[model samples]
Target: MAKDFNENDRLIILNLYRTHGDHYTNFCEEFGYNPKCAREIIRHAIKSNGVELNHGEWSEEEVKKLKKVVRSLMKKLQLQSYDGIPWSRVSQKLHRSDVQCRQKFFSKSTLFKMIPKNQIDGWNEKLDIAKFIALLKKLNFPDYNMIDWDYIKEKFSSNYFNILLRKWREMRIRIPNHQHLSLYEIVDHLYKTRVLKLFGDDPEKMKEIDDFINT
Candidate 1:
């Protein structure tokens, strides 16, 4: 018999969908569940909660709308601001940790269901498409010793880093452009990427990353 999932588990599954997408295949890979079971949950959500995945088997107009929503939602997660929401700042405004804000503001099912097909005019249209790419760059190719986890913990608090640490675990993102990077040499790269967003981007800060990685 399949065990019933708790609300938290359900939220994790839902977030997996939101973070990844509605395709049952990604769900199975990330959550270690059969794709059929994952798809069934999605179907159940649609029936009971009005949640839908905007699957491809729809009318052209409907499919276009769904695809638009799918693209936007993926974009939203990577944003510093969306529709002027300053989603990254929502944690400070709500007086919660990122993880807490995620749980309270975005119920997993809600996150999955709300991916907008037709971008409403008010939401952030000018959102940066470069942040995650930059993030991955910072992770994979540390050029600057600009990362500082202690400062990140101080500025954003432990909960912030903790939440991201969970993501780091889930995604297993690591220093990729390492011609010389060992595991300990990699911590500085991790620090710069996760900790000091403001100061890390300067090209001058990269000297330490070069020195540390080369040493």
Candidate 2:
């Protein structure tokens, strides 16, 4: 007959499975347990207890710890994308899953707080009039839904597409009679009159205009 396992025994079996991986059956044999019985107990425990997960709102300390661990791992691994983060390892430290850790880190509120103000401001400033005009010309002043946001993000090296969309809407509001003007007409008008004063002798802006014109 199989032994009646308590909570402690269940935990032991689960730990053994975690530590021994696929060879856990061998470890169970060494410990005088029927391998099949041990496996059954582990399956039941995992179903009921969820790999010892602590599911609820994250504590402030946990948030701080997550930030620290992610930064260390990213630097050590020289990771470029968030997908490269070893969330399984992070979960071992934080008692969270890779999915949970990733979701928390990339959640809009958390991401907003994590990004530096200067960096956000820099992204905001990137869609200047020259670039906006250039993009409008290239895209043929397509409607917001018609724009290929992923292509725009890649081409402009911008982090967030929503920001770009917002900036475009705001820019359109600033333009006079924008609804009636074709992109070429708008550029010709801006170049002939408004562009110089709007840029105000900024050499970088002049260079951007020259580059756009040449292209």
Candidate 3:
């Protein structure tokens, strides 16, 4: 007789289904269960979660609406992490499944363009050296040299790290009489001034600050 799965087990099966892209054979092999049992567990999990499988092509209007909703949520929550997004709330507004909404949002370059130019300006206004330090500490890389640029790029879903770093450098360089200060002291001075803002209006000055820091 096949063992009955509990709620937790069903959730795990559902997650596995998503991860494996509906590969029942992989699920069976992993759980030592038959394909029929695996399919039943997944179906039950989907139904119990009230997640509608609306696998239809999204319209242009829906895409625009999704961007608007996400932008609003980002500003409201001061969202820092992509995973922290409330997909359930988004789905409720869009009348789509949470999985569908999430998958759609990440399918192309949609996430990168979700932040408006005005929002970028808003961020620049509120940003300061102290906040930058706090963010660095929060990301567990307080030291500029210790930061994993690739990891940060992937985490924020942004490819503009070079531009961001160049902006930071420009802000740092603006402090007068800083030529005599050591790298560490310059960082401390910026912390004291609390006037540094990341990301300049111009994108042409972007260069890899990683190379500068590493050397």
Candidate 4:
């Protein structure tokens, strides 16, 4: 359990909060507490009128304003019509952290529904896993330690790449005698069962990805 805050701690909280605003990571580090604990303390302070905190849940009006700002930025940046929303701008306008903006935008209720269907499908996690498995098979189960992490990061976005590494490790442990199986067999086994149940079975995606090894 987190320790109860005392008078000195409350003073420190108000001071750091005034200095840091919503930059909770740095605030928590300096105050020797986790983000959850820091938020609780800050909220309590605000309740007691110790400090003013404007940041809160994004209202419907805020979401509408955000969409407008995003549309404007897309035009100025010359980003593709279907490109991902720029969370940095959203964070600045909303006075929230980039992670907070991203989490709010991509939460299940919003992400898949808000973005273009094709774009969402294109960034599917299974595709990355399928691609990784194909590479592993061709490399003959090469020592993961020998693999260059930088090169792997280049191949996939940071978030999906982490997922790729995790799933690949899990597959290596769960699927015994993997060396004896062809890439297609391994992919098929993973797809047919719930073990790695990829969300959608887009025929074109499967065909494009399954014709691997040579790539």
lDDT of 3: 0.56
lDDT of 1 at 161: 35
Which regions of candidate 2 deviate over 4 angstroms? 1-51, 122-215
Task: Order the numbered candidates by lDDT, best leading.
Answer: 2, 4, 3, 1
Tell me model 1's lDDT, rounded to 2 decimals: 0.42
Cα-based TM-score, every candidate: 0.20, 0.40, 0.36, 0.39
lDDT accuracy of residue 78 in candidate 4: 82
Which candidate comes out best when scored by lDDT? 2
Pairs of residues at least 3 apart in sequence or in different chains that clash in candidate 4:
none
Give per-residue CA lDDT, model 3, range 1-215, as digits (tens): 22576656655666777777556457566766667777765553453355535446798889899878877887899975454579877876775777777777765356546545554453332343344433443455445567665665453324233234434565566878766755555566654555233433323311222222223
lDDT of 4 by residue, 13-53 (tens): 66777877777547676657676776776764453334353
TM-score of 1: 0.20
For model 2, residues 108-165, the per-residue Cα lDDT tens digits are 5566676666757655344255565555555664454465555555655344443444
Q: Model-by-model lDDT, in order?
A: 0.42, 0.63, 0.56, 0.58
Tell me how many clashing residue pairs each candidate has: 10, 0, 0, 0
Question: Candidate 4: minimum summed lDDT over ten consecutive residues — where?
Answer: 45-54
lDDT of 1 at 166: 37
